[model samples]
Target: MPSIAPDGKPESPGKVEVQPVAKDNEIRKRIADILITTSWFGEPRVAVQEGIVFLKGTTENDEFKQWAGDLAKNTEGVVAVVNQIEVAPATIWDFDPTFQELNDLARGFVRLLPMIVVALIVITISWILARLTVYLLRRGLLARSLSHLLREVMARTGGMLVMLAGLYLVLRIAGLTQLALTVVGGTGLIGLVLGIAFREITENFLASLFLSLQQPFREGDLVEVAGVTGYVQRLTSRTTVLMTLDGNQVQVPNSTVFKSTIRNFTSNPNRRDDFIVGIGYDDSIPFAQEVALKVLAEHPAVLSEPEPLVLVESLGPSTVNLRVYFWLDGGQHSWLKVKSSVIRLVKRAFQDSGISLPDEAREVTFPHGVPVRMIEDEGAVESATAKPTAEPETVATKAEASLQSEAEEIKEQARRSWTPGENLLTLSSSTDDS
Candidate 1:
């Protein structure tokens, strides 16, 4: 019908003819062509009416049906797609040819049986060689000086590497080179991940190895490390064990023990002992010094090689502070016991020599009107210069002598106590002996 002209008369439509539009059938044919050419699409029936594509037919699977429908939906001039394609169910015919295929596969494997047997033989030989390599490295290559635990670990690691190499060769002989490469690549990736996760463990392990080589402190040695003082009980790959003086066990990480400052008391048998004595400022300094020096020199535990020293270190408000220094054989006796004895002996000498170890004194000033009361004890008061009832030697000598006897007994017990495990050098000697 021509459009109505604005003038009441039917306007003559311009001599124009509408070209015929392409029909849905042509679009359907193009969509079918596209579906047929797609590899994933099986036989899917296609129909089109009014530019809407309808898919219907049986395919091998749902994937083919989906792919055919998608191609139809994207076809030019397609309005919509209705997918009703069904997937075919397997029938006895599907298994008809599998028997022949299996037979062929068996024949092929039979033909390759000799190669398989040879590969297995190679693998078995490789395994045997790996074990032999481990034995040789453990008994010959590794130094006896190495810790036994470390030596074993290194030997096993070398064996594992050899075994892996053998496995790679077997895989290659079996025409499985791609599989071997895949395994190797995967192993490298897994190792990277584990190394990152166990970084601290690896650090402590390496630190322990270095410490073993350094031998800073041996088992049974008394050491101070990372603010802990104790006798070293054992050393392992990860930690150093210490038995404290109170008999409690402490486990320190090897990294901390290696990095921190360590004080090995038993490294040297001799150590210096120090004590401060306050004497009256009015007393003769020279006399006080001479008496303290003589007491230290006479003590049996004190070392005579390094002469005992007495120095006036500082002056307090009331008395003079004299610092007494003496060298004692730490291994022979307890340092604390000897120092206690020296203090007692010096105090008695001061009293006998009439040199006062004075207390700090201060004059308390009060307001002008304040009254002060003096309190006195009911007990008898002994004068500072009173003569001794017993001999000065008897009073000063008794306490130290008793302590020394007890300390000697303790020292004997400690000496008799033996610990387990061997240091690196000891292990080396034992290996040689065996």
Candidate 2:
């Protein structure tokens, strides 16, 4: 039967056609010709038998060997392919590829010369703009009252923003818009990571900023903050330094200072001090109060406006406890020295007036029995029973004589220790109550 074509035409019954199958030798020859044309393979051998092709060769890389196998497998009449090509070990270093790469890079650089020039110009202009911005900020009237640290921070931040904007523009001009975006995104990510990693440091930094702006306390001011009572020596970026009454230096973290309650004793010139004084139960409370008030009134350091107070606070086991409260000019007089003087004078007054201040009464018990001893001499007994005469007036100590504030000494010490610029506080701003 004759087969009909797709066009519906009848084929001739006598016409017969046969296509010859490609022999294994022909397939081998074709692959050999292809491998010879390329310089990738060396000493490549090709074999074919029974319509199956075999390939073996040495090439500089596996990619070239695979190329040879693919050529053989694609040849006509090839039933299967066995590729056993080995990658040759490189003996001598090839500098041609390296030279070619360098040459390519050089050409690329030449092509980007105009963009590089533009970027350099942009960087220069950005630098100038940043400097100008900082200069203007420093000289601006709005920033005149700001603390030195705050002003510097603001100026530097503005300059940095300008520089960043310039960088983004330069990247866009260089046809690296994606890189620019990455830089912008990466900056935020990096900042977040750094903030997390250095949490305490960041907290302290922010606290210092607030402290500077708030000006809660000033250098040389007596302050009790973060469980430390001392004269504020200086406020720095990381810590607030203090000189204690004991002449010891203490550095409290700014974060702690900001969070803790700050008691600025120097903020108010008039500061009150109190001490407990106990008198005998039999002693007249009114007489004792009058005597103590007289002593406080006589003291030069005590403020007369807020009349010194002597109130019956609590009754002790053997005595009447009185709380003596007095106000003094803290800025002019040392509260410690003034209080000491007042106490000494009060004690003298009480003693002179015969108002007895006694110790706590305690009953001693004898577990076994009470022992008794009799005096042999009558003179000794008489002398023991006799009351001693009143002693001469004692001279007041230096603390009582001089009630000057100790902050001056602390301030001098702090000044000697650090430069004025290092301190974030200004003496002029110290008086600001707000």
Candidate 3:
């Protein structure tokens, strides 16, 4: 006769009832078998009765306990899984009571006590060191003579950098980081996120740091940046304040200042001026040059350090171009004012000497095959009417002509609009759009 298998399906009847019993010994051996076969989960203490497996063991956590119970329940003849897992708490030696524990604790305290004392001593010493370091760096900057703002920035930043690094290592030696990591996700993650989000702020701060370190220009120094010419008024951690030539205040990012090429007009005390003096072709080049040199040298604001230069720089189509170069004391005189004064002086000097000055110039030569125009006479030109002539047509006739012209123009425009590219647009656009 046929019988049912352990899974309740049909099996040979001969295998019926010298039925196996599962107990502690048999279950343990089977569990070991399960472990050997799985190779990932360790052996778990198991007791099986009528194919129901009861699991008992100490494990790291629920996941490990579940894995062990699952392994036992999946073995042959197993019907169900019952887990009674005992979780082991993290082992810390602090609260153990024994002679060995006491001895170990004593030894540990002895070993660590001196380090604690040393740390305290070092901290006091480092505070002194930081103050001394601050003093020395500040004194050095003062001796070399940096701005008060710049010196203060360097002292604070440099001192803090040194002090903070020393402080972190001391906290580490005291096991601060290890203790913090055990609770929740850890302070490391908090620090990492903070670092990422504040990266730009860090860069700007460093830019300010560079500003302090380099001392590129002081307050009231003229600088041109991003097409704005201004005098630097204040420098801060995030931005630099500039007062523009138009008397407007502008704030520039410190990072942009660090990244860009800055032109400091006031860096050098003396500045060079250049301009072209135009005189008619009939005027003498040497005469104009001499007059320009006189004008530049006679200007009180011009510096005596660099000698003035005046020369016939170019021969133009209708004019002689004389270039004048001289050193000016600074923006003590405005650029436009100085330029205007020089041009006026030269113009007056030339008028007094009977020298002619022309406005615009271009070369015109008799090139064959080029068209030319000649006006009849100055009197004829004066008598000519500049406006277009009006035809005396009636209003109805004019309106009709205008209507016909508009119709023709509309048709012509429509024809011209159907270009090759326009055809592509016509094809791609929706029918409704058309």
Q: Identify the leading candidate in terms of TM-score.
A: 2
In angstroms, the error of model 3 at 302 is: 3.1
**Can you tell me which runs of candidate 3 are displaced by over 4 Å?**
1-196, 360-434
The residue-level lDDT of candidate 1 at 129 comes to 85
Candidates in order, TM-scores: namely 0.64, 0.72, 0.47
lDDT (tens digit, per residue) of candidate 1 on 1-434 = 32334652333323222125546777766666655654334475678888788987676666556656666665657778899878776575677469879999999999999988988888888889889988998997565577766777788888888888878887888889999898778778987898789998987888877887777876667789999987776677788877766656778888999999999988897889899999988999999999998888787778887888999999998889999999977766677777887888888888878998777554566768788665464433345445667535532255445433233343344445553434343464355457
Tell me the TM-score of model 2. 0.72
- Write down the lDDT of every candidate, Cα atoms only: 0.74, 0.81, 0.63
**In model 3, what is the error at residue 277, expressed in angstroms?**
1.9
Return whichever of 1 and 2 wins on TM-score. 2
Q: Is candidate 1 or candidate 2 better by lDDT?
A: 2
80: Cα error in model 3, Å: 21
Candidate 1 regions exceeding 4 Å error are 1-115, 141-143, 171-192, 199-204, 361-434
Q: For residues 36-140, could you state the per-residue lDDT of candidate 2 as single tens digits?
A: 776557788899999788888788866566666666666767778899889996667878878989999999999999999999999999999999999888778
Among residues 3 or more apart in sequence or in different chains, the pairs in candidate 2 whose N, CA or C atoms overlap within 3 Å are none
lDDT of 2 at 410: 77
Residue 62 lDDT, candidate 2, scale 0-100 = 64
